[model samples]
Target: MSLPLNEQTVLVTGAGRGLGAAIAAAFAREGASVAVNYRNSGKAAENLASCLGGKASAFGADVRDGEAVAQMVANVKVRLGAPTTIVHNALADFSFNGDARSKLDALTWDEIAAHMETGVKGALNLIQAAAPSMRERGFGRIVLIGTNLFQNPVVPYHDYTAAKAALLSLTRTAAAELGPFGITVNMVSGGLLRTTDASSATPEAVFDLIAGSTPLRRVTTPEEMADAVLFFASPWSRAVTGQNLIVDGGLVFN
Candidate 1:
């Protein structure tokens, strides 16, 4: 469905704060009714909703819980219309303190599962819940958030990077399955963002080093990455799917 920006209703997972909030606000700015899904940050989510005006509302649900995700989608349907666009920006709680992160040998199965619970499983829940409505209407937009680690494992964030890699696979497979239903599934990944809740733990020098390394000579911002996500949701990317676009400034060329 090549729906206009104003005619779309967007569901942005983990949209209470940080990068998620930026994505939600970006959708609202485009005149779409925004369902800001938050798992824990209710107050922050509520405040964001208020700031977004009447077109946006905050809904809390653990994406890891399939039933909860289904129910969340139902609530969004009644309140802001069924979400025709879904941006799975939700992430497991993690900080980008590479120095303190576990290496491959130290990483346990449990650690890996935790990230997948929110990254892969959460994405599965949202896709399943939204597929029915999307197929029925013959239009849907699903954008999964990814990372540039696949090309350049700059940090030893083993579990986190692994989870995102799985999500990338899901993106392509889902795109193949849902393309017939007028649903476009894609991924938008970025390099270590300049400043976000998760990346706050990163050292200042690391940021400076990364900025110097990039061709743009600056770190990407959450807001900038949010705009790239909008492309997949908008009509401009009508012919694009099963693809991952890296928004980092010449960090990793894939």
Candidate 2:
């Protein structure tokens, strides 16, 4: 299934590594010019861009900051092109293996704010910045990288899960609002990705539990989730919006 995104421009946040990098590469393989957005992993992002083998440039910015996000979008337009498609995959400073026991009592407000600020605010920033162009072009695809854990809370990532839940709501609201402008908003939620920097902190036992319980009896890879994101970002989902597709090896079926 080839997605005809040739000559199109896509901006993927958190593209420095993990699922973000895979998603960027997927779009690049489809001949789309990709703007790899990263917060800190500069070298990693550049390396991913190089491997993309297409028109790819890395843009560094904290997606949580609106001003930074606006500037990043400007740079993408000037350097690569106006991004007609946006993939919101950025996350705040969080660790999957972080102290979950202390989260309820010791986690500061700043910690929760930091997480939400990036996932939710960053996603909105990208949408607001790139939506105008998409509307003018009469075509746009906004795919948000969410967590299937929201539906089935196997872990105790309170802040992260809450933020993703809010982002899911935003996806639906954006879809309804942007639908009139030919822009569709959707979400791709995954569970226990095989290997990724973000998931590096996850314990092997956790993966075992999820994999054993899933119907496929295995964990999914970043590349697999990337395929799901590609579907939403491509023309095949033109009539689809406000939908959260969970790609977790059939772990959660709604």
Tens-digit lDDT track of model 1 for 1-254: 59988899999999999999999999999999999999999999999999999999999999999999999999999999999999999999899998989887787999899999999999999999989999999999999999998779988688999999999999999999999999999999998997999999999999998899999999999999999999999999999999999999888887
TM-score of every candidate? 0.99, 0.95
Residue 63's C-alpha lDDT in candidate 2? 92
Q: 115, model 2: CA deviation in Å?
A: 1.1
For residues 82-136, could you state the per-residue lDDT of candidate 2 as single tens digits? 8888999998876677444336777677777777899999998888888888888
In model 1, which residue pairs have backbone atoms overlapping below 3 Å? Answer: none
In model 1, which runs have C-alpha deviations exceeding 4 angstroms? Answer: none
TM-score of 1: 0.99
Model number with the top TM-score = 1
